[model samples]
Target: MRIEPAFLFDLDGTLVDSVYQHVLAWKTALDAESIELSVWRIHRKIGMSGGLFTNQLLRETEVEIDPERIERLRRAHAEAYQRYASGIRPLPGARKLLAWFTEAAIPWAIATGGRMETAAVNLAALDVELTKIPVITRDHVRYAKPDPDLFLAAAERLDAPIEGAVVIGDSI
Candidate 1:
């Protein structure tokens, strides 16, 4: 007997062209807080956990930030991302690929470094119906990308084992 493989996808740049939108949103957030980090610098931390991103930002910029300010930045980034959400679209063949998997009776799920607060927008852009799809976001797990938690949760949701899962993502 052989177990079927599962495909785990990342939402942002992999499915939707929303990487730069997130980058810009973070820029807006940093700017709102009077933090002077360059966009390129922010892009380097795009697909990691937000807590880790903030910690890295502080470490690289040598800026002192409190928990309150960090929360404010997160709120600001979410708001800013909404402003850019309308411009986001599914990457070419992304919807097709998912549909193909569905047609083939393959188990698949979306796992993103973003929280539901933000992944919701990308999912909408991808035209993925959350009612029928298993999406694991940062809100669902203790950690995000580069940690395996999101993918692990997604596999669990699909009732698939992590051992032979294929992760499709643009970044770590």
Candidate 2:
């Protein structure tokens, strides 16, 4: 089947196999705070921004974690994540799919909830070309996924119509 002319993809589980790293980071961060949350539960919140995910997870556990405290833990999680940065790898067929788009002259972009700095670091580890593809990350939008802000921003920046653009993600 012919692919869509414009492709908008998620960065984490879609392009790179960094979900485990995210889980590890969250686990380490929560552990530091003496809060024992399961990695499986944290894995379920992987796609959202650090602050949002932390809030959601805390609420699920019925824990009264201050927003400021959550932010601190998020920072620590980011630091812990950097240690496993080298383990990041592109998902099977991701590079091939990207190359196919390039060769077919189909425009593509990334719309991820991750902060731009973190997204850049992960993309660099995966050897993706930031300059060649448009990236609409958390820094580019006030709201994240399920809100359509990030994807809309990416389509806008890519000059691709939303109706004709395909949003590809591993999960809803």
Candidate 3:
């Protein structure tokens, strides 16, 4: 017997055209915190967990890090991202592909490193109904990408084994 593979997707840059928005949002947050960092540098950390991204950036910039500042940055990014949400849209083929999967009765889920506060914007662009779809966000898991928690949880949501799933994303 062969098992049908399940598809696990990333929401931000994969399904929605929100990667640059995320970079700019981070830039906004960093600027608000008086942290001077290049936009390209922030882009490099887009798909990573926010905590990891913040810690790495602070270490690289030799800046003092504190929980209070991290919270502030998170809030600022969420607010800034909301400002750019109006510009977000589904990728050219993202909606079509999802439709095809639905028509074909394929099991799929979205697993994003973003927490719900920011992910809601991208998900809205994709027209994803969270109640009908399995969406594993950073808010639902202890760790994010590179830790496999998001993908693992997504696979579980689909009742599919991790070995029988494929991850689709636009980042590392």
Candidate 4:
């Protein structure tokens, strides 16, 4: 018998409406460093790892950030994100879509660019059952989207083939 296709869902923009919330959080964090970035620019780096995201923004804007500042910025972002995470919610039909996949016996998991702390908050906000769900977050992989590492990890966790797996996310 042929194996079924395993689905990898992105937690931020795709399933939940936390994209802008993330922007605000990052902005707040960067503000602490006195680094100002346009929301559009921040949004563009949302799907990348924290270090890569910071480096990209700095490169694009021609700014300078030391290693200590980078570490501080990461911590600040996580704290700020949690502070503003209460307002997060699921996207239209996100719950229904998850339910449909569950009821249909589809294999799925969350592969997100979010940190584990924020992932837990978003998952609780959405009330999505994750007892058996495998979630691969930024902490789990060396790279983020467009790299296929996250999806590949999820597929491995699901014991499914990667060739036929479909990734679902709202980011460009």
Give the clash count for each candidate.
0, 0, 0, 0
lDDT tens per residue, model 4, 1-172: 6768999998988899888888998899888888888888898778676778887787786777689878888899889999988789998899889888889989999998777877888888767667778889888998877688888999999999998798898766
**What does candidate 4 score on TM?**
0.92
Q: After superposition, how far is residue 71 of candidate 3 from its true place, in Å?
A: 1.0
Give residue 55's lDDT in candidate 2 (0 to 100). Answer: 84
Model 2 per-residue lDDT tens digits across residues 22-138: 899889988998788988999988888776898888889887889688877878888888877888888898888888888998899989988875687678856678888898888
lDDT of 1 by residue, 39-111 (tens): 9999988987777788789778888868998899888999999999988999999989899999999999999
> What ordering of candidates by lDDT runs from best to worst?
3, 1, 4, 2
lDDT of each: 0.89, 0.84, 0.91, 0.85
Per-candidate RMSD, Å: 1.0, 2.6, 0.9, 1.6
TM-score of 1: 0.96
Say which prediction, candidate 2 or candidate 4, comes out ahead on TM-score. 4
Compute the lDDT of residue 129 as modeled in candidate 1: 88
Query: What lDDT is reached at residue 139 by model 2?
Result: 83
Off by over 4 Å in 3: none
